[model samples]
Target: MSAADAELRQAFAQLQAQMVETQQRVSALEPQMAGLQRAQLHADATLQQLALAGAGGGGGGGGAENRAYQPVGRAFLLQPLPELKAAAADRRSNADAKLEALKTMKDYLERTLKNSENNLREMVQQRKEQASS
Candidate 1:
C-alpha cells in the first residue's frame, strides 16, 4: 500500500511538471504570434498603397507604369508596382503561415496541459477512494 502511494505521488509530480512545461511553451508562442500578426498587417497596408499607386498611374501617362520605392539592405530601390505588390503579398502569406503554425502548436500544448491536469485529478480521486476503502 505504501509503495502504491509512493508511485501515485511520483506520477502526480510528473504530471504537474508536464503541465508547467506545456504552459511555458504556450506562453512563449504568444509573443511570436503577436509579432507575426503585426507583420501581416504591415504587409496588408503596403499592398494597399501599391494598389492605389498602380491605379493612379494607370489613368495618366506616368512613365508607362507605376513604381514603388522599396528599401533594400541599406538603400532604397525603385521597384515596379507589380514587383512591390508581389513582395507584399509574399510577406503577408509567410506571416499568416507562421501565425497559423504557432496557433496550432499553442492549441496542442494547451490540450496536453489539460490532459495532464485531468490525469492528475483522476489519480488524486483514485487515491482518495483507496484510502476510504
Candidate 2:
C-alpha cells in the first residue's frame, strides 16, 4: 500500500473506534435521560397539586398545619408542607439541570459521530483515488 493509503487507513481505524465509543455513551445516556424527564414531570405535578390544594381551600380551617411525607432511603419522614414543597422544588431544579447536561453531552457526541463519518468517507474516496492512480 502507498504511504498515503497507510496513513489514511490508520486514521480511519482510529476514527471508527472513537465513533463506536461515542455511540455507546449516547446509548447509555438515553435511559437515564428518560428517567430524569419522568422525575421532573412528577415533581412539577406534585407542586401544582400542592398549590391547588392551598389556594382552593380559601380559609377552610386548614390553618398553617399542613404536613407531608418524604422518602428517606427505605423509610419515610414526616415533614411540614412547606419543607416538602421546598424539597420538591429542589428535585425539579436538579432534574432540569441534569437533563440539560445530558442533552448537551448527547448533542456533542452526535456531532462527533457525524464528523468522524464524514472524515471516514473522505478517506475512503482518497484511498480509492490513490489505488486508481
* TM-score of each model, paired residue for residue: 0.90, 0.86
lDDT for each residue of candidate 1 in 42-125, tens digit (9 for 90 to 100):
999998888778877755566337777999999999988888898999999999999999989988998898899899889989
TM-score of 2: 0.86
Q: What tens digits encode model 2's per-residue C-alpha lDDT throughout 1-133?
A: 5786678768988989998998999999999999999999999999987766555555444725666667899999877667778888999999999999999999998998899889888988987886789
Per lDDT, the best of the predicted structures is: 1
Clashing pairs in 2: none
- In terms of TM-score, the best-performing candidate is 1
Clashing pairs in 1: none
The Cα error of candidate 2 at residue 21, in Å, is: 0.8
